[model samples]
Target: MRRHVPGVPLQRWLLVSALVSAALIAGCSARSSAEGATHYLLTDQPTGSEATATGGEGLLRVQRIELARYLDVEGIVMQTSDVAVRSARNHLWAEDLAAQLHRDLAQRLSNQLEGVRVLDPDQQLRAPEREIMQLTVTVDRFQGRFDGYAVVGGKWRLLDSEGEIQAGERFQREQALTQDGYPALVESLKDAWTSVVADIADGLGGAWGR
Candidate 1:
């Protein structure tokens, strides 16, 4: 047997529905605003934005770049122990890890090489023929360690357009944390990357001078 139910007045039902809708809207707005508040930082200075001139010696194209599989995510990772790792919840990469690394490497090298035209992957696709040399890099370690150090280790190869290898070597470096927190970690990471760039530029020898 069905029991007769009292109906809510039309105006009261409409008011109830509006309240529910408003609550949902506010919740969604808060969530989206929180997500937008996440922080993003580059590992090195952007030479392109520095108003530096280009096209002096030759084009150095980034043929390929690969980041560790675990670090392929948007969140930054830190190895808290040998067997454990932690990722930042509110701190994140604004772009793909490999792509950002490639851009930073290309631009930093460009700044150091003077006349070299750095062709990041995007630019490489546009002017393949202009690239006289290629650089391929693989990042093996790129994370904050338990010891309060930001470590970066990788291998790179510089090759001529003819595929002849010009320079090929491995690089590893770390920046000691001055204090604590993500900002310090990021600064340390930048320092580590800067060290790697210095070595890579040195490997180029007189390539920059030419």
Candidate 2:
């Protein structure tokens, strides 16, 4: 039996289809935040380097440590052929590498500096009353050598509230990587960052009469 009924307008039908497609796409795109998350280490209580003089008196106490600026936190600005080789084996991307390094430093510093307030780099920009201390870290070079070795090195600078330079230092550390690829590289980088941070802390403490 043939029957005739009112039909939807062409424009109305098109809109309906578009809306339905969008809904489907949104539903499919939903993802859990922790799906591929990685954990990082923090230096809650850092010990002074052996080279640091232990007998220094009149150490000044820091009221706070602020990470007030990250205008130039570019991830993976430099890479080497060794990085490509390791990436192929470990399936690690440049962004992931940068993120892991950043997380490790943040956590370690937060733990090490107790009683002192730690400010997020992004949040520091909003509050004018608080003193602003900027720390800039640059991964100038990262490579794994063929002599059964891996090395990571970089430069960092600290600036005071008025944008005056406080202290600057460079560090490099290398270690032998096992079968693991990116993880090994990360570990080596962590070691390098630890050394660098300790130096910065010691220098700051000395400058402030601590």
Q: By TM-score, who's the top model here? A: 1
- Computed on alpha carbons, the lDDT of every model, listed in order, comes to 0.67, 0.43
Q: Give the alpha carbon lDDT tens digit for every residue of 74-116 in model 2.
A: 2211122223322122122334455445655554445544333
Candidate 2 CA-lDDT value: 0.43
**In model 2, which residue pairs have backbone atoms overlapping below 3 Å?**
42-107, 42-108, 43-108, 43-112, 44-111, 44-112, 59-210, 60-209, 60-210
User: If scored against the real structure, what TM-score would every candidate get?
Assistant: 0.69, 0.50
Q: Candidate 1: list runs displaced more than 4 Å.
A: 1-37, 47-57, 122-131, 206-210
lDDT tens string, model 1, 54-130? 44446777665798788887767776545766566556677787777777777777777666666656553444445
